[model samples]
Target: MASPLSALLLLALLALPAARDAAQDRVDDGGGYEDEEGEAVEEGEGVLPSPGQRQGSCPSSCTCSPDGAVECAGAGLDSFPASLPADTQLLSLQNNQIEVVPIAALKRVPLLRTLNLQNNLITSAGLPADGFMVLKELQYLYLANNKLTQTPGSLPASLVSADLAANFLTAISPGTFGGKPDLRSVYLHNNRLTNAGIPRDAFLGSDAVETLILSSNSLTRAPLGLPPALQRLHLRNNKLHSLSGGAFDQLRDLRELYLQHNQLNDRSVDAKTFTHSRRLEYLDLSSNNLTLVPRGLPARLVILHLERNAIAALDSQGLGRLRSLEYLLVHSNRVRAHAVGAAAFRNLRRLHTLHLYSNELNRVPRSLPAHIKVLMLLHNTIHEIRAQDFAATPELAELNLSFNRLSTKRLHPRAFTRLSKLASLDLTGNQLTHVPVGLPASLEVLRIQQNHVAVLGNGALSGLPALRELMLSDNALASKTIAPNIWAQLPSLTTLDLSSNALTVVPSSLPASLEYLYLQNNRINSIPEGAFSTTPNIKGIFLRYNRLPPHVKDMFMGLEELQVLDLTGNFDGTPEPGADDGEGGDGEGGDGDEEEGMGNPQKELPQRRRAVERGTSVPRPQKT
Candidate 1:
């Protein structure tokens, strides 16, 4: 082997050729870049000339492309530039003070394909009847965030996309998009449109319109005469309280529909509405005042969102018809058990996810489809869970019953025996006295905190072989009530929480796989040596607010891999009654007999034993 200095020099020499080649491959043109028109534009060093860079011989404060594209955005020009390149294909004069668009002045760049005059003071009264018709090649036009009072007309026949959103346009007159065979998308959202303002034939002139966005308007009813090729429609954030039965009968190709944040009520929807939209797949009717699901929805729908509605009932005739539906969300409603009969959802065979949270149901809904994998029932008044509550849904993988009034006695002994595939179960914030048994062996996470569970019986965790996290905090358990081998059967246990209990010492039989142990706010008074010998992999141990013995360092000697050990709030160390007599002791304080036997005649008062306080670092023990 070469010496260290010689090896370092050899590596540097091997990288010299490759580094030089990489540096030589780069070229610099004095920070000048070519534009759309094949002309050079000067920018700063190491910066690419984009739409913000000014070019030579172009208008002041404007960027010109080599292929004849110009951007004069935020230039403060009162009107169109007088000296633009005659062959410019794209012109962006947005964020200016131009009050009018002079087509005669723009006749120079007749080949322009895109024009962006957004965020200007342009008004409809300032333009001629055939204003934009002069640019026959215009394809994409944007006039959003302007002061236009009316929709522009006589647009170029080749136009494909138009955006007039956030304008003052109150109505869409006939022939607004007429004869434009290539116009496929139109945005009229954030306007003052209403039912009477939109003519019946507003979109009759265009047969190729595929996407229409009319949200945040004043419309109270659905728009009519939508093109047959329309696929997506957004009418959210409006006052559409009712929809005519024939409102959507003409849309044969509609697929996605959004009508959320409207004032629609139960009587606002017609019976025959949406019956003709055979290809519809997604529907959102949230934030409405409806009392029930609207009738006549297409059978091919996949996701139905009715969250935040006031619907009170779910009958078989209303939901059973949706054979292909997969997701049904009716949370934040007033639904009751009697309102949803037993067979209300029996026909929804393919349903996989059902959310009925924040409802008025007294118990878990019955007749849930067998394919349900996730069930959410948080924040309800449910007080009990029976063995058959989850018998119908054996494939359940996640069940959330938190924030309820559940009791231990009300929970049947065999309540969770059928959930063989369940992985996560949350019973937090309830009134229980013990860890419910009969849990599946495949459970991985069990949370039962914020309860009155006083003790964990011996067989409470016997069946949970694959358990990894066990949270039993905020209970009234003590070392006497807990079995000595409570944690012995949990071979895969990693995180154990026993804080805020009445423990007197560190429980024994801890598994080797344990990593995090929480025992804070307990009555533990002693930690003997070899207490944690089986748990060498432990990393964090919280013992705050405990009455620990004087020799705390000996208590942590077995924790070789410890990282964070909290021993705060402990004031003094005094042996509990009979603790020093080689007999059972509560370990809370020293007995009077042992302390008096020491007598008060000792010479230096036997140096006071200082406890292991906060921030005391322990050296990691050497591994064997």
Candidate 2:
């Protein structure tokens, strides 16, 4: 039952792995090598000469296709394989014990365009002094997850993308990537690189480099002299404490910048640091030491993640310029209601989701964007909700105010009357003694659990025709206080949870569309036959930990769709006559066969059938 805001954040974090895998797949597959005629040659279609049979044959331990692609990964070789095809265009030697990449072996594949040497034991001293300069046609090189203590100097000028991640590199030499005009991506993350280890002009000549990932390093400040063409930069999980004014002065085309999990503070970032990045669309600065929302954000930003900071206020200077912003996550901060300026979010016309949960606010912030659809303000100290709290946001669909100090008396009578499109409302863990009045008719799910509610007035649920799920568990409701026809107003009601209440017998007149009923942990002793006759489509009934006596099987005789019936922790005594010889009658407390059936009822039916063979009487519902 995760909230929508939490689920969206999880999806964003999981996208990193998918992106990495896609990049690796492009390097591994080589997009199908070309033949001599420049025609596309699909892999596994052309078989080359057998290994160890000729001078230009494939290595004995590798597989070669007619398109000049060789794969020798995980071959357990101590050195580079010999006798590679002279026209090899793609070579994969990853996941091997090869420590040295002899230059002579690469001379055979002078046309190699993609070379993968990742996940090996290759060290700096083991590589050639001039790097892979002999492979003149190389375009993609993957040397990640190796033992290199320094960058491989003088990479081929034709290199387009290089992956050097998860290495022991301590420094990047000046000319490591200087002259490659076609170099577009460079991954140097998960290394021991420091600010001083990189030269000011380390990437001076690589003007085409668009992506630079230097995350998981020991950088205390932004690197200098970044390429002007850089479009995406990932510097997360570093020790960066500040961004000097000129750090991003040259990156005009930057679109996505990730600086999360750093030590950046309000003063550490200059106001003009991002002034030149006008095209920036995605920015993530979460898990930092920021005490205020950074100013001078790009107006074109679509997603901004500033959660898990120490920010205490929101002003027009920090948020007024972002008009295209759609998702704003500022939760887990110290934002207060009074500290928020009146025009803080006045210009964000396209914003749809705003998450300010776990803050210090005592009331909803005024001037919320009108078009926002989801607002999560849970885990706050707000005690009252006024009538105009959400007057401007009529398009809001889901609202969560759980884990607050809100009481029915302090809440205005028409607090939520304006939210005509609100579909789900969660007010759990509150101090309300009764359900809030004037709920919108469009509400489909209402959860007010863990409260002190003891009564449901006659019209408490009158107009909610679209309500599907109502969870009121952990309350003080009693069977006598519940109106018998109260559920008739909700025609679409399917799931109702009334467990952990003070009901003596099952409530009657349940909605006919009810599918699941949870009345466990009550004081009920009898069902009064046909208690569930109206709910013909009910599938699961949980009445455990009650005072029901033995031989209650007759109560569920006509429930054709009943799939699970959990009667555990009840009927605690010796078995009645003609009952099975077991710990309790009707498999009440034995081995939890009935209890475990709550998830998969079909798996527990055989055990019950065996009990019936031992002189026990169990009701078996027939499926149509």
Candidate 3:
């Protein structure tokens, strides 16, 4: 592997001079197409034939000049063969192992406009300013991932877009990008810009500069006084602890602002921080220590990212003001109980995505907007979900309630009764003793990994016929979870995640549409006899970290169609009963079926059925 490229092994005829000389000798000996000067005629410049053209004495080197265009990528060459193509407009050296860019080599092609040196080993120490200055026609320069310091050695005046990410440049003076006046986009992220003050000229001279990415730098303040045309700016993962109130005031046309992963406290931001940027739509201030926000933010903000903050809580008053907010991501915050109301989201009519994961709440909030489509509630302290908790969320399509403190006693029968359009449901990482039912009929993805679920009584997901992905790994269930007729119940399930559980057996009749099946880390001496019954469409399977028995036939059976299968962490043999597939049938059946729909509904069934199944199953009181 080369220094800049850990990929793509190919060889190019780097010794173009030798090859060309030898071919010329051969052509001269044959007296091929001799001109009046008695010199053997050879194809020159753009007159060179393709691989299928004139056979004798073809030039080994191909170059593009400032006016001509040349692209020799993926031609099975490891290095840049030589020879200058004059007046080239564009030259691409993509996906090659050319250890060193012939900077002087490019000088021969003075008319070059666009030079793409991406995925190469052109280093900074070898970068000569003279190698780049000759190409006076250069406009776009893509020099990504090539151990370079300051790219291009210099920016040409006509250049428009410059991509220099994933490099090791520690210093960029206003002089570094001095020439480009028509520049529109500049990418300079993932570099060693430590404790450095960005030059005032960092964004100077660019009358058309619109987007700039200076991420992963060491800056304590927002770069103030940006051009008015600046629209998109990315400054994530920087030491921006202080943001001036007018840091972003000059950019009247700014739209998307990404300032995540900074150390800015609440006082660092102000309402007037975005006073004139009325057209702004997306604002990402995630992973910051902002506890207080100034009133009257941009009213028409389409996305607001306040995640991983110390906002403490969100009562009806504070959140009610953002009338036009669409996506509110405040996850990983200290927001706790009594602060969030069901109606708190009712005012945000345009709100569609709400991410409140990792909070300190024991119960679900009420009056959440029914119009919200994506709701993420994972990694919280929620232990109970009342009937009206999610009553108004009718349009919810994706819901993630994983990593909580939920249990069988907390699942309300009508909890999801109103979410008819719900699609993706995540209940992973919790204390659930069973798979609660009456899931939205339109759910497509369900993630319930890492729970205390003990059994799949039956019809656990009968309502979610449209479900495509079901993740239920790391639980107390055993072979009982894997029903051979699993597909018969949920025919639409496409992805199943069942890793880190007490699975001594695998479900044989899983849906054939399953593309991803995760079943790692559990106690199982032998593979289930019904593992993957006719489900050849499975593309991947994870069995790592489990005590899987060495039964070759059962282990790899029906796995030819599987593209991935892991058998990691299988230590012992055990059996648990959480795979309840409503042997009692769909929700139409009274108490027996309710056992799989909602935990409490089963208790409402007549005592006669409980008496009959009491010997076979534990019949808890249903609280319908």
Candidate 4:
């Protein structure tokens, strides 16, 4: 029933008798221990020091905690500190300048469980053959981000994880990790490993290995003899071009396989390469040379990324086995409308995301999964959006059709009527002359920039009660064609872009919730006193490259929340005296005669005033 401290005190008392007996025996031996100076040293004095004087050794900048842990990171140290505490269990020397790990450097710290030497200049030659044999209890070791050309030897058998990534290791020799039965994770990515340099059974000794990361290597063929318990394998950014029979037959527990950015093709992949990877959930085969979807995909796959390939079509058989697939990314391929089968995704009821952007499709793809929530077809040749093109996905939330050949005449009136839950629609860089109508009420963002929409009609965006961002920049919208109450219905609108247009005056009747307003690169000559009076929430306004008028009073009135006001390149006019006093005067006192506009626009105020009074302001005629 004794507490830990009480029992330790009792043991100390018991050891005192034995200590006295040892001292008596030493006295009976005719002489006690002698020092180098022939002085007879008293028994238990400095030789067997008291607990208070038994301090352990540590580097000047390092902290040795009570639990035998030492940390000396970022010290610019060029070598391991001499005389480390023998009981030290954890040592962190990360971010140092130490170039070599000398043999016997850690021989005294036999209890070390974790050793961190990341971000150093360690090389294979710096580590002796049996350099780490002294650390019998080491469980975790990190040598990543070093200059090693080969794996360090003599790793403790108790090691659980070893991180050797970001090094110059060219190959993994046989028995490199031999006898490490408890090894669970190995990170060798970002190295120069090649298939010819690695022995066939390099991983045969690591029977318990679960995660192997070989990404960013030069391996032209898949490594052999993978542990059966492997769950995750990363071979991305490699030269792997093929998979042989039974390549993954033993990896039944594999859940994630990353083969992206390789030279893989149908001819290089075994027809049954993934036959045993039934539990795999994520498969990445993007950026390859495959002309068709590789067959024998697991039915439990949750995500398949095959973008940037030579696959020219969506073959029904290619997707027939992935019934549980939730995401299919095939963008940047050669897929054309005619190459896709009518039932390409017929069995993918759980599919929620599909990416077909940057392809050769000339029409809206059909027969997409019904539960799709995100659809990307941007950078394609699709010239039209006909009715029911996306009718199957009523729950679509994000659709990116930007950078296509879409024109006003090719859009069906009810093209997006079925997508009631749609939240974002991108139509930038298209040929549309006007904003499409019937946008879902739940929409939050609309991008239609770089188009020819000369006019924004009333009710063009009436149904989008939740719209918050509207981008209409780089268009041909003129102030005369934009309705005075164009944004009155967008109560939730927070951002509006009308830059690079033909606007001669700021659009009036902006929404009260407007926050960011971009009107740069336009012909706008004036901002009326009440122009921003109702938009109290306005935060930023861009008015550069415009023909701003002369002296004006209360031009920024009611814009108390505005943070950005861009008036660059505008006509410079003497502030009517008392301009800050909310009154217009015929004064000359000002900050100075600032230069702006194509010429002195102050002389044209009378014309601008008349134009404003008539509820229309045409851009001034340009001189030939």
Cα-based TM-score, every candidate: 0.69, 0.79, 0.66, 0.81
Candidate 2, which segments miss by more than 4 Å at Cα? 1-98, 108-111, 503-508, 519-528, 531-624
Candidate 4 minimal-lDDT segment of 10 residues: 37-46
Deviation in Å, model 4, residue 306 alpha carbon? 0.7
lDDT of 4 by residue, 182-290 (tens): 9998877777898876776777778899888887779987887777899989888888878876789989999999998889988877558888889999999998998
Model 1 stretches astray by more than 4 angstroms? 1-131, 457-459, 465-624
The residue-by-residue lDDT of candidate 1 on 1-624, one tens digit each, is: 765423433443344324322322221111211111111111112122343333334688787766667778799877667666666667778778767666554565676777877667777865555767767788778776677778876787898878777677798767567678898988777778888878777777688888888877888889887777899888988889888758888888999998988999878876678878999999999999989888877888899999999989988767878999999999999998668878878888888888888988778777778888888888788888988989999988888887788998889989889999998898988898888878888899999988988877788789788999989888889888888787998999999999998899888889999999999899998875677988989988888789875456445644547766666555464432333342333322233222232322111011111112323443333332
Model 2 lDDT per residue over 549-585, tens place: 8667557655767766766556774334323444444
Query: Model 4 scores what on Cα lDDT?
Result: 0.76
Of the pair 3 and 4, which is ahead by TM-score?
A: 4
Which pairs of residues collide in candidate 4?
Answer: 433-453
Please give the TM-score that candidate 2 achieves against the real structure.
0.79
What TM-score does structure 3 among the candidates reach? 0.66
User: Per-residue lDDT of 1-624 in model 3, one digit per residue for the tens?
Assistant: 352111111112222223323433333243221111101111212232332222222124443222244656554445455564444455667556555655546655565566776556656654555456555667667765566665544656777777666566777766556646788877766666754546656666675788887777667787754556788887877788876667877787888988888898867776567678788888888888887544556877889999878888675455676788888988888777677765667679989988888877767776777688988888888988888887877788888887788877878877887888877777877777877867767778777777777677566767677878777766777776544454568877777777677777665667767778776666655665556665767766666566554342234433445444444233333211111232343212444433332343322222212232233332333333
The predictions' CA RMSDs to the true structure, in order, are: 15.0, 9.7, 16.8, 15.4
How big is the positional error of residue 130 in model 1, measured in Å on the Cα after superposition?
Answer: 4.9
